[model samples]
Target chain A: MIVAANPIGQAITWINDPLNWTNPGGMLDRLGEHLTISALAVALGCLVAWPLGLWLGHLGRGGGLVVLISNATLAIPTLALLTILPVVFASGFGKTPVVVALAVFAVPPLLANAYTGVRQADPEARDAARGMGLSSAQLLRRVELPLAVPYLAAGFRTAAVQVIATAALASFVNGGGLGQIIRTGFGIGIAAGGGQIVAGGVLVAGLALLAEVVLGGVERLVTPKPLRRGRQRLGRPRAADATGSA
Target chain B: MSFRLSYLADPGNPWFSWQYVRDNSDTILAAVREHASLTGRAVVIAVLIALPLSVLAYWFRPLAGPILAVSGVVYTIPSLALFAFIAPYLGTGATTVLVGLVLYALLLIVRNVVAGLNQVPPEVREAAEGMGYGRWRRLFRIDLPLALPGIVTGVRLATVSTVALVTVGVLVGHGGLGQLIFAGFQNNLYKAEIMTAALLCVALAVVLDLLLILVARLVTPWSPRRAR
Candidate 1:
């Protein structure tokens, strides 16, 4: 009987409803809030994960340790991380605990991919750049970094998708996002709440897919010619990102 | 099973202490057990199916991209939504969670397995083939062992991520540590249960992942550590 309020149908209803288009609690506002949260958190995550991974990858030391560490990061539950962070750091950055939690969640894949991307760069090319009298910075910029661009973008793609999907959890902690609809809808009754939850799920999933498609496109644009034939190369960057669990 | 009278006597200490955890050992252990069984079963089942199919898929290069794309898209679905979507049909039980986990895992597991298979040194396969080793014999003796480190790496990633994802099952009442985390949050932020669950879940993930790595090392002694 309740299947009529099918998740897909419910999603369409929620999307079509004009009421949601208007106010503080409207779909647009929550979408904006969700995007802002994910954007800020991903930015913070890259700031930390990118430089550290870049340094580690460039030095060619601790490669095993870095991958091991990043791999292990996938094991800790994000919900647990989100909850534990607030209690552990009860003082600093009082207003945006969710951002901090999400940033932590977003770090592993970005770090893992950035390191692997740079570390995996063509060694011969790296040496050639060096032999040509390029400074350390120039070698990194002109050769290694460019080659690693696909991976860096891959990291961004994975991190962005994850942060956006997980950001829905913020509503549980009184933070703003589309999850608010799902949470409130559940309390109201299935026909309404259930439908809303379905719709909200669609929104989150849609956003994640959008991120994947967009980033995958960007990754393709930056990839060098020969590497394109080995589409399998895209697999490594993406594989680590998937290691970041729900 | 028993509460410490002295700890209870002090009403002023509002947060969780070691005593509180000691008192609730039975419930906590049960939840952990439930979580392990659900997640463990999903992984075991997935590897069994994925291993064979992926090996074939690797052999048949034409099918690789399409199959992987379908599975990858499945992974893109958010867990909660996937759970909800399936719940109505599956009737909201442990079975439903398994269905979701298995589907989510298929892509990650299958893709990694295929990737691992593909990475096996071509010469080793050629050598085995030249020896007139039967296909099955070659797969078991040469290709599999050589390809194992990669396969095991994929398994490690899949298992670890699966364990972490099991926590989301708290959305219903089935998730093991997830239930503790959810209950603690709902009950006025009972710090002890929340902290215990958090620490325990993390410990479980790290330990399981490390255990897999150690196993991988033991199995692939010939493979030197090289990653990019």
Candidate 2:
């Protein structure tokens, strides 16, 4: 039987072909690579940003500057960052450059959210904790941190989703990921590779949406019980507040 | 750093070269123009589309959640994936990038529009109505004026982000400064070219942001926040 000629048909045929998924540097390998890069970048970002953000928030110092800097960072295009890192590092096409770029992209949401979350914690709770003779560190560990869980979770969700989506660009630098499928398809020429290209796009988009949904659940789950009821009143976390996440 | 054109061809491949800038001034200007135009057009169109939809959502409270949700989902999609998905249908070029950029701008614009509209005091609207102002007139003269600050803020955010995202259009061969950045990366990692393009992008964002802030101030001279 003749393979269907439409792009969607070709994409379906491409996905249906078990050989496509099982082959080396195929969909599964790309998927694994994508996840690894995303995970590493997000972890690194959190390590650097969380402590700084949380400390600043607790101190109520540099909050305005943090917001300004965060906003400025958002204006840096993701593509430019991805391309420039490798040049600055003098590294050839590989995961390191991509990871660093993605990490930079991930920092704003995580840092801003963490800072805002803690700073916006209930003033009464802070007073009570202080009144009860809690130490500074104890106040942070027991009172502020717990209350900041939802914000932290929301920030994590945004970072993860943004990284997962941006990870597709790794292929442009030969960093290898699901983006490789799309890049490879382009190399093969659109006429023959339309299915492959479309398939790659589908996979990346689907994976990003999936991360968003899953992390959204995690964000909900991590909210303290009393806060859960007031979640709507608190307002939805504005993920768009991040620059390149768009 | 030398002004000599030969420095552009120097074997050392330095990351910064004034010679390169002199030689490529036209190309650089063209890229900047393209980047700025794409960003400006996308944001303008997004505001147009977002404003009416925002009004609808505000007037009909039931629609606000879904409107915001859809835009949020669109924003969540990776820029490359969206471009790739649309390329087949639209083919590659400015059109594809413009469409994608506009979609990305919608969430910021819509949210801001809604927020701006919400900031209008109920008493002002009531006062406008008491003066026999028509519904549309009240909205135009009362609601929108008060909402201008928030709307401008949204426009500022969308414009800056779009400036950055315009580089992704290079995926479809339309990424203004992104073209230079990509070309430099491909040409054995030409650091000067990449750095120049990237820096210009950041500079452009800053300039536009400042310009919008100026516009916002001029438009909302009466804002209490401004008085403070």
Candidate 3:
């Protein structure tokens, strides 16, 4: 039976552990590797999902099927996929498999959000673009895409969070990351108490919070100012109309 | 079942025999049943806890942001790690799994609850107040009804997430569809195990999705048919 040690104490002990301090660079390197894997997975997922989402949104056909498949993919549990993939491909233990698994997991939100965002773009604006002799590509690039940016960014935010969180699960299959610290902390000798466990939990939780803050910052930076200004303008007109009618 | 030439042709191969598949049917059925019951319990517990918490969070706007943030942080923890982390405190049982699932659902439910409450037109609230309805009466009789659609949507999303997350319960030796998945990995029966787990999970998700749609229709009879 495990003893219940104070988490704060354990965290202190973990921080003071000579081994962790000695190879602080190693820990940072591992964190970098984890980030690299997560970033690549998101990038690849965006590359594939963005086009599909755009096409699906534009056509408004095949959306049911696309949504079904994407939702199904989302429902596919990470651990289950991790367990199954390694068998089909023998090389599933390391970074490659982890990246692929994460990418698959990441695609659904990106696809769904992008599709919804594009479809939700102002129809009048789209029509105006077309009436101005803008090509389909130009319409998408300048009108629909820009308007859809916030929604797409929201999707990316979700994907980024999920990827960072699930990356820890990769350690179960010996895929290295901050998860290594977690697994090692848990797998230590039988007398192990709350300290190491809490420490590990803190590490993972810390990483998750870090990812959210960083991605949230990126989202704010990338979102166009004109969109916010337009929304504000729209809101004011609506409120005024409501007041006038009232 | 009738024996075929193909069966006889590969008599030496274990997989070629109908007996092999037949022999495993009972085990598979038992596993499936066990998984269903565990998942059902987890989801029920999650809804029960999340619904009230969501309502409370909605009522207290000052607390909404922090509550939602905390839940979001909880949501972002890897399911397995979360389960493992809590297993020690709660012990490895359905109770622990239930708590974890409930915590996960909080993020989605609280946001939806708040959104739904906020979506209630200020005029409606003012009209209710002007008509002398009390806070609880207005909330239940007017606000909640209007917010039903959004709340239902949130529940649907939470249902899907809860279903997916329950698979991690298997790691702590609790029975679920994850059992098939883990077994598949260990025994190298990839197709049998993975296919079963994937199909079951997807089917559960679809079923929940449809069930929630029906519930929404029933609850909000006058609601527009627009999809969010």
DockQ each candidate and list the results. Answer: 0.33, 0.42, 0.26
Error of 1 at B170 (Å): 1.3
**Candidate 1 residue pairs in backbone clash:** A185-A193
**Per-residue CA lDDT of candidate 2, range B97-164, in tens?**
99999999998999989998988888988899899999789878888998998898789888888888
Model 1 chain B: worst 10 consecutive residues (lDDT sum): B4-13
Candidate 2 chain A: worst-modelled 10 consecutive residues by lDDT: A233-242
lDDT of 1 at B29: 95
Candidate 3 positional error at A50, Å: 2.0
Instruction: Indicate the residue-level lDDT of A60 in model 1.
Output: 76
lDDT of 3 by residue, B1-228 (tens): 644333323324332234534677776677666666655665566667766776777788787778777876676676655765775566556776777777776666666777788889999999999999998998889988988877886677777766667676664556477777666655534455566666676677678778889988888889778776
Better of 2 and 3 by TM-score: 2
Candidate that would win on lDDT: 2
CAPRI verdict (incorrect, acceptable, medium, high) for model 1: acceptable
Better-scoring candidate (lDDT), 1 or 2: 2
Say which docking band candidate 2 falls in.
Answer: acceptable
Q: Number of clashes in every candidate structure?
A: 1, 2, 1
Candidate 3 lDDT over residue span A104-208, tens digit each = 877777777778778888899989999999998888888888888877776787777778777777666667777666566556631364555555566666777
Candidate 3 residue A148 Cα shift, in angstroms, is: 4.0
**Model 2 error, position B210 (Å):** 1.7
What's the CA error at residue A27 for candidate 2, in Å?
Answer: 0.8
**Model 3 alpha-carbon drift over 4 Å, by segment:** A1-3, A21-32, A57-62, A90-94, A120-133, A142-147, A189-194, A229-246, B1-34, B121-127, B211-228
